[model samples]
Target: MLPEVPTEGRIPFLDLTIPIHWENHAILMFGIWFVLVPFAIMVVRFGKGKPTTYGIPRGTPKWAFPEVCWALHFYGLYTAILLALAGAGFAMLLTGGFSGSLHAWFGVGTIGLGVLQIISAQFRGSHGGRKAPTSDPDDRTTWGGDHFDMTPQRWWFEAWHKTAGYFALFLAGGAVATGLSQFWVLGIAIALAVVVIGGLITAVVLQGRGYNHDTYLSVYGTHPDHPFNRRRFAQMLEEKDRKP
Candidate 1:
């Protein structure tokens, strides 16, 4: 037999009940974490342009196609975090407080990591490059942004943000699994399976087709004189020297 819908608690102002709140929370979190967040990550990962400056000129607006990938990732994650907080707040209010359950912990951890992702992004430093608005394409001296130079700050930020984002998604999956155990929603379960499998397959196909261009090269082009590229090339030469 299916589990009965929870209808005990009443909404604060309106005539709605706890089940409505629960459903809303579930839908919001599911859509944010499973659908929207995954799509954003995938787009940013595979939607970057080729590592050539032919089509994308210097000082192209950040809202353009290839650059827009970062914009989409930025806004999508911000929106997800905000909606997640709202959904979590609603759930907490309906339940009176945190119940210390495994699901509750998973939910809290996921939301916490989402918040950290936003906070870390703020410290990702500047985007100095030949393509930056502040940079002069002909003046290599002006292209000194943290990302362009691959400074320690930017490197650490990328390391934490990318890894933690994936970890947060893993926690979200745990939350969803535990939530399903409590709510027994067949629809949500099926949706989870479909979204996870579909996202994996799509990511694999895009990667196979060489859509996953290097982020640095995509944004700054393949100019060997670029600081990061220069450093990378030097490192490769050093490694080759050491291989003897």
Candidate 2:
């Protein structure tokens, strides 16, 4: 059995007496990883505007519906990162530096991955497409952007950012599990299970209903001349030709 924490006093650990606000820490971290972060991910995953050639003109105001999804995702994750740092800092301060425990290590790993996600997004290159202000819809020559051309920079950014974000969440699951093992909160534990199951069900339903559109097709459109589409089409033809 775990040792009981005394009221109005520090909790005893090996060679250390640490001040811990268990309730506050649990609430803050639970809301961030379980509630806010998942909401942001779900919104971006299923809330993209339907794939259309003219969808979301480049200069469309940021407050618009589909555009707002991106805003929520961008700002929501930023908020989570900041709050996570604050929570972790407070805990570390009270604990007098790292505890070198499993929970502590998991939290550190989760936060490190979260910070890297933000830094990677900053270098995602430019947005250039048919609807971009710098491009003319009638003239493909003006569509000269890293994204429009599927340049190496943009491709690598998407590859890393998308994959890393999910991996960070996986680490967060580990952190939450380990944290609860150390200081179990029944409410938070129940909420975590409900949220995970609900999120999976929601994703399956939305994906089956065709809500998970391709990022390129949703933002840029299905124009045959789009660089990415053209390349994909060429590759498909080559694969077909190689078949018996």
Candidate 3:
């Protein structure tokens, strides 16, 4: 609690009261959601076939990662935006304008997540492409190439991603439940937790099947790596040979 006495009717900078619910708001919305969204998306995308090789898409862009288990970019962006908003709101709260405990906690949680999002984006966007740090490097790739280095392995990357996913969900859920007292907020928080958890479980079960990395990189037809599968390269070759 901050001292209410202010000299000359002005609260001193050192006496600013901390927002009551900063941890819940910032940690939950930004911190948790920042990591959770991408994790959830990746679980669906990569886990579609098998946990390791990750199933290939029937039709996929050549630039895509085959075993991408989730799309964290969305979560990153959403968390960042929320972080900014919460920071502003926090300023108001500290200056004696706003004073909702729920709002404060959520704001703090969200801001923490926003910082994480920025860190992740910077790491992924370093090579001028949106490839994550764990993505496999294209065999023919270089610094000036159109892709970055990231690949799925049974060790580090998977562990980081999975741990982040579970932790984020828990933080987001618990923050809402414990920090906020409003009825509507409670309902929304519980609903969000349920949705995230359900989606993750379903996607993981779907991923147990064998995943083929080449499948996700094929453009229009079967992958060259696939036996008896016609390839897009054949069409490209044929088109190139056509006389104008």
Per-residue lDDT, model 1, residue 235, is 98
lDDT of 3 by residue, 58-81 (tens): 334433553333334445455545
lDDT of 2 by residue, 1-244 (tens): 1354322333335445654668678889989988888888988899888977655676777778678889999999999999999999867766556878787888999899889989999888988887788888778788879887899999999899888888888888988888888788898889898999998999999999999888788888887878999999999999999999
lDDT of 3: 0.43
Residue lDDT tens for model 1, 41-129: 99899989888852356756779887799889889999999999988887776656686878899999999999999888899999887
- Model 1 scores a TM of 0.92
Report the error of model 1 at residue 117, Å.
0.6
Candidate 1: RMSD over Cα atoms?
Answer: 2.4
Quote each prediction's TM-score. 0.92, 0.91, 0.41
- Model 3, residue 164: displacement in angstroms? 4.4
Greater-lDDT candidate between 1 and 2: 1
Q: Which ten residues in a row have the lowest lDDT in candidate 3?
A: 142-151
